[model samples]
Target chain A: SQQGEEDPQALSIQEGENATMNCSYKTSINNLQWYRQNSGRGLVHLILIRSNEREKHSGRLRVTLDTSKKSSSLLITASRAADTASYFCATDHDYKLSFGAGTTVTVRA
Target chain B: GAGVSQSPSNKVTEKGKDVELRCDPISGHTALYWYRQSLGQGLEFLIYFQGNSAPDKSGLPSDRFSAERTGGSVSTLTIQRTQQEDSAVYLCASSLEASSYNEQFFGPGTRLTVL
Candidate 1:
């Protein structure tokens, strides 16, 4: 079973706008990682936030984790057409990762 | 450095036929993983291997699904008596180590179609 569930199954926004998606998990995790999938094929690792870490940033991406709530959110600032893809949140535990269904984001050009 | 690689970018077979999918992890990567993604669905963990230790097969859905990793570098996932529901993208990933702190590097998945 999937551990995480992403809110807002889909999102559309103009280029240069900010896009935000939320993920909620059912169990504890050692770390939470976000990945991006293009064309429903390969998924690329985006960023990871350990349970002890509250937030992390990488380029245009920002991630936050709240262990108490078992939730995480990913924010993409200044969205670009290239950034349009399905974003997924994965919870890592015991050397395995459970992924959420995903949020499909469309950056209108 | 090269990234993880998977072969037979796409495969189509009739039901009941056996199929094999291959994955080649990046050099020196000690941990390899296999996942399956159905249409519009999240990835489902299929199997995991770390170094020479026994693989964690806890996530495999059925007896027909089996995988093996050799020399801690290359891996193969095989499906016996394929079913229509078995059609999905098979993804392979490898991490530098087994630690949860390491991010996995993924391969361009192989799309499997069971007719």
Candidate 2:
């Protein structure tokens, strides 16, 4: 079974708007990581938040993790056309990453 | 420095044929992993190798799916007697160590089409 599940299979917003996606995992995790995939190719690492950490930010991306609820959210502020892609949340347990179905975000210009 | 690299960016094979996918992890990386992603789906863990330890094959779907890592640097995933349901993108990743906090670097992946 998959360890994580992303909510809202797809999302679309204006270029200047913000995009948010949530992920829920079934098991305890050491950390949660967000990844971006373009053209269904390789996945690019976006942000990682440790279980001990509640929030993290990098550039225009913000990640929040709530171990109590076993959920995480990724927010992309000031979205751009380039931000159009599929976002996935992975839960790190032991040494492997279990991923969810993912959320596809489209930023319309 | 080079990131993880995978071979045969794309592959198409007939059902029942055997296919091999290769992956080259970043230098000095001690942990390597394999994953499969179906269209519109998230990645599924396949295997994991850390240093000289035995690989964890818990995620392999069946006997037809196997993988090996040589000298702890390069890895290969093999699928024997491929089935149409086996079609998916094969992804490789590597991290500095097997530590839970370590982030992994991914390769472009090899899209395998089993017909």
Candidate 3:
């Protein structure tokens, strides 16, 4: 069974706009990681935020975790057409990682 | 230096036929995982391997599904008597270690279609 659920199952926005996706999990986790998958392709690791940390940034990606709320969010600043992909949030517990349903975002040029 | 790789990018087989999918993890990677993603659905964990230790098969849906890892480097997932419900994208991933902090690198996935 999956432990995480992402909101905004699908989103579309013009290029250069920021896209935000939210994920909520049911159990405690050691860390939460995000991944991007283009249609018919493999997933690419985006960023990982440990439980002890609250926020992390890499390039145009930003991830925020609120363990108290059992939720996390991913923000893509200044999105581009190439950023269009399905974003998934995964929670690592013990040695197993559970992924969410994922949010599909489309950045139109 | 290469990423994880899976064989047979696409497979089309009869419903009663058995199929096997292979995965070759990156060199020196100690952890490997298998997952299935149905059309427009989330990934479902199938199995995991850590080094030479016994694999974690708790996520496998049924006895029809089995997996083996040899030399702790290559793994194979076998589905006996395939069914229409088993059609999905089989994904393989590998990480440097079993720790939660390690990022899992994924392969392009094998798309299985049961006719």
Ranking by TM-score: 1, 2, 3
Q: Which portions of model 1 miss their true places by more than 4 Å?
A: none
Q: Measured with DockQ on alpha carbons, how good is candidate 1?
A: 0.82
| Candidate 3 Cα RMSD (Å) | 1.1
Write one digit per residue (lDDT tens) for candidate 3, span B1-115. Answer: 7899999899999999999999999999999999888865578778899888888898898999999998888999999999999999999999998886788889999999999
| DockQ of all candidate complexes | 0.82, 0.76, 0.74
Tens digit of per-residue lDDT, candidate 1, span B2-104: 9999998999999999999999999999999999999755589999999999999999999999999977788999999999999999999999988868998
For model 3, how does the per-residue alpha-carbon lDDT over A7-109 read when each residue is reduced to its tens digit? 9999999999999999999999989999999995688989989999999999999999999999999999999999989999999887677889899999999
The local distance difference test score of model 1 is 0.94
Candidate 3 off by > 4 Å = none
Ranking of all predicted structures according to DockQ, beginning with the best and ending with the worst = 1, 2, 3
Q: Which candidate leads the pack in TM-score?
A: 1
Q: Deviation in angstroms for B49 in model 1?
A: 0.2
User: In model 2, what lDDT does residue B71 have?
Assistant: 82
